[model samples]
Target: MSALAERWRAARPKVAGLHLDSGACSRPSFAVIDAVAQHMRHEAEVGGYVAAAAAAPALDAGKSAVAALTGMTADDVIYTTGSNHSLDLLLSSWTGPRTVACVPGEYGPNLALMAANGFDVRALPADGSGRLLVDATAAMLAADPPAIVHLTALASHRGIAQPARELAETCRGLDVPLVIDAAQALGHLDCAVGADAVYSSSRKWLAGPRGVGMLAIRPALAQRLRPRLPPADWNLPMTVLQRLEHGETSLAAQVGLSVALGEYLAAGAETMRAALAAVGKLTREALADVDGWRVVEPVGEPTAITTLAPTNGADPQRVRDWLVAERGIVTTHAEVQRAPFELAAPVLRLTPHVDTSAEDLATFRDALADATEEV
Candidate 1:
C-alpha cells in the first residue's frame, strides 16, 4: 500500500459513519480545509485589496495547480461558486445557430437548463447498464449539429460512470462543441473530456469547501463564450460568472478553493485513483452477502461510488436518517425520478475517497446490517 492509502486507513476509524455518504470528501479534503483556515487567518490581518494582492501568487499558483490537475491550460480555467453555477455561466452564454443535445441519465437540471435557455434539447438513449450510447448522441449532433453536446462525467443519482471523454471525442469528430459536468468524477477519474467546456465541484471528489467549483473552457472556445452580462477587467478577478458576462466573486471562498485544489494535486491523481479503487473493492467484498443491497457499478467500470439500498419500499431517505441517527453515518438517498438539483430524490450514495479503508467499509456494512433489520 502507498503512504497516502496508509494514512487514509489511519483516518478511516475516526468517522464511524453509519449512513455512509462517504463519496464526497474521503480524506484528501482535510488538507484543503487546513490550508483554507491558515490562509484566512493570514488574510484577516490585511486590507481586502492588500490581502488579495498579497495572496496573488498563491492565487496564481492555485490557477496553475488546478489547470495541471485537469490537464488543461491555466487560462482555460474560470472560477465559479460550484459546478451548477459554472454550468449556468456556460448555458446562459449560448449563441448557437441551431440545436442542442444531451444524454439521458445525466444530472437532470442541466438538460432542463439547456431547454430553459432555449437550446433544442435531445436525449440520447442509454443501454441496460445505464451507460449512454456515445455514437448515438454524436449522430444527433451530426444531424443538424447542436450548439452544444453534453455528458455528466458521473450521474449524480446513481454511481453510473458516463463515458464522457468518449462522447466528448465523438462530438469533436463531428466538430460540435461539448460540455462535460464532471462533478463526481474529479478524484475518481483523471479525464481530459476533450470538450469545449467542462465543469466540476470541489466538494464532491476534490475535497474542497462546499461552495467552490471549477469551469474549464478550451482556449479556442473560452474566447468565444459571452457571460450573461458584460465583461469586467480580466485581471480584477471574475466576480460572478455571467453566461457571456462577468461579475464579482467570493474572494475568500475562491482562495479556499485554490488551497483545496493544491492539496489534491500534492497527493497526485494516480495515488488518489488507487485509494478509491481499493476502497471500492473492499466495499464490494464486504457487502457480498447482503441480499437487499445492490451495488450500482459493474466490476469493469472503476468507481468508488457504491450504493446499498433495501430491495423493497425501504425509503432511501429513512435509511439515510436511520444511519445517521443510529450511528452518525452521513449519506444521501437517490430518487432518480425527480430533479432540478435540490429536488432530486436522495439515494444511498457511498463514496470512498483517497483515504477510505477496508475496515471503514466493514464498519459501514455492520451499520447497514443493523439499519436494514429495523426497516
Candidate 2:
C-alpha cells in the first residue's frame, strides 16, 4: 500500500468506513464542514434573513472561488442546488429548435432532459474507442444541423475522458453553442475547457458539501441566452445568470462550497489530480489479475473513476451490498442508465481520492474477492 497525500491526510480525518465512492459523493474536509456549521450558527444567533445578509460577502467569495476553479470570472458563476438542476436551468432556457448534437456517451440525465424538453438528440459519430470524431462532428454540424452542441467532458461510468477542447474549438468555428457537463471533470481534471458554458456538482471530486453546484457562462453567450425566470420586482432588472439563480438559496452550503474550493486551491490542484490518478491506476492494476473481474478504463487516462464488471456472472449489486454489510467497504454501482450507449452492463465503480491509501485499496480488493465468492 502507498502513502496518502500528506496535506490531504492531515486535513481529512480517518473514516470508519473504507470510502471508495467519491464519484458519487466525496467527504468534505473538516474546514468545509465547520464553515457550513458556522453559517448555521450565525443564523441561529441572529435571524435567518439577517444572518444571510451578513454572509453575503462569504457567499460572493465562494462564487469567485468556483469561477477560479473553472478559469472564469466571478460574474460568470451561478450557483445551483446540484448538477441536475444546473443542467435543467441551462437546457430549459435554451430557445433553439428541438435538436441537439451529442456524443454517444452523453450523460443519461442530460439525454433525458433533452428529450423531456422536446429536443431531439442526434448522436455524433465517434472513433473506434468511443471518442467523438472531429471531422464527422463538423460534418454533422454542416449537414443536419442541431440547435446546440452538448458534451460530457468525462463519462460518469468507465472514466472515459472526452476530447472537450477539440470539440469546443470546432463548435466555435462552426458558430454553434457548446455546453459541457463537467460534473466529474471539475475537480479531477484540468477543467478550463474552451466552451461557452460549463456546469458541475460540488459534492464530487471537489470534496465540497452536497446541495451546491456551479454554472459558468461565457460573457458573450450570457446575453444571448434567453432569461428563464421573470424579475421578482418590476423595477429590478437581473442578468441572465442572476435570474437563473434568483430567490433564496442555502447560505450555509454556499459558504462550505467556497471553503472547499479554497482548500483545493491551497492544497494545489495539480498535486491532488496526480495523486487521485495514481490511486485509480493502482486500483485497476490490483484488480487486473482478480479472477472474475475486468477493469474497464484504459491505462494512462487522467481520471479518478475506475469501473469493473463481473466476468463470471457475479451480480454487481450483490457484490456491492456484501462489501458494505460485511466489510464496511463503500462503493457505487454504475448501471446502464448512467450511460446507455457507453456501458454495456452494470459495473462496480470505485472512485478513490487523494486521501485514499494503498492499504485501503488492498482491503477493498480483498473484500471484493470475498464478496464475489459469498454473494
Candidate 3:
C-alpha cells in the first residue's frame, strides 16, 4: 500500500475486510471518531449551547476547509444536515422563476425536489452515456437559458464524470447561476470549479461522520436568495449564508467533519485523488476478464467509481449480498431508480478508495465470479 493508504487504513481499523463502498459512505478515521466523542463528552459535562460555543473556532476552520476545497470563501459556506437538506434550502430560498436545466440522468431525489419546488426541469444535451456535451450544452444554454443550471459533478449510478468545469465556464459566460451537486466528487475529484453554488455530504469521500453536509454559494447568488427569516424579537447579526443555516445543529458531527477535512488536507488532496484514480483503473482492468459480468464504464474514465452489469440477467443485489455474506467484500447495488431517466437496469457499483490494494481487487474478482455462478 502507499504510505497515505497505509495511514488511512490504519486510522480505520474497523474495516477488517475489503471495503469497496466509499461511494455510499467511507470508513471514518479515528481522529474524526474521537472528535465526535470529545465534543459529545464536553456536551455531557457542560451544556449543549456551551459546548457549541466552545467549538465555534473549530467549526469556522471546517468552513474554511470547505471553502478551500470548493474555491469559495468561508463566509459563503453554511452547514446542513446532508446534501438533500442543502439542496432543499437553496431551492426553497429561490425567488426567481422555477426552471432548472440539468442532465437527464440527474439523481432521482434531486428531480423529485425540483418537482416539489414547482420547477420546470429540463434536460441538458448529453451523449448516450450521460456525459455532458460541452459545445452542445453551451448552444442550448444560449438559446434557452433556464433560471438555474444544475449539474451533478459525479453521478451515483455510474463512473462517467460530467464535464463540470467546462459547463461552469459556459454558464459563467451566459451569466447563468450553476448549482453543483458534488456529493460524489468533493473529495474524490477536484471540486474547485466556478459554480455559483456547490453542495455535498461529508460522509462519502471526506470520510467524515454522517448527518453533516455543507453548501457554498457565491456572493452574487447568496445575495439573491430569500432564505427564511429569523424572529423579529431575536436581534442576531448574521451573514446571508449563516441566515440560511438552521438554528440548531449537531455540533459533534460538525467537529468530526472538521477533523476529517483536516486529515484530507494533511494527506494531500492531489495525492489522494491520484491514488483513488489508480485504484479505479486497477479495478476495471482486473475485472475485465471476469466471467458473467462486464465493466460498465470505459477503462479510461478518470473516476474512482466503477459499475458492472451481469451478462446473464442475474440480480445484482443477490450478488452484492452474497459477496458480503460469503466473501466479506462490501459494495453497493445501483438501482435504475437512482437515474430512472438514463439507466436501463440495475448495476453493481464498486467504489474503492485510496486504501484499496491490487490484491483486494483480485480477491473481489474471484469472489464475484463465485457469486455469479451461485446467484
The per-prediction CA RMSD against the true structure, in angstroms, equals 3.7, 1.9, 1.5
- Please give the lDDT score for candidate 1: 0.67
lDDT of 3 by residue, 187-292 (tens): 9888998999999999999999999999999999988887767642475776677678976778899999999999999998888888888888988999987888
lDDT tens string, model 2, 135-199? 88888898766778998887788787888888888889888888888899887887776788989
Lowest lDDT 10-residue stretch of candidate 3: 230-239
lDDT of 1 by residue, 125-227 (tens): 6787568887666666677676677777777666667887788778778877878788878767766656777788777766667777778777666665555
Which 10 residues in a row give candidate 1 its minimum summed lDDT? 238-247
In model 3, state the lDDT of residue 298: 88
The per-model lDDT (C-alpha) reads 0.67, 0.83, 0.91
Best by TM-score: 3
User: What alpha-carbon RMSD in Å does predicted model 1 have with respect to the real structure?
Assistant: 3.7
The model with the greatest lDDT is 3
Name the regions of candidate 1 deviating beyond 4 angstroms: 8-19, 25-31, 231-247, 337-346
Write the candidate numbers in order of decreasing lDDT: 3, 2, 1
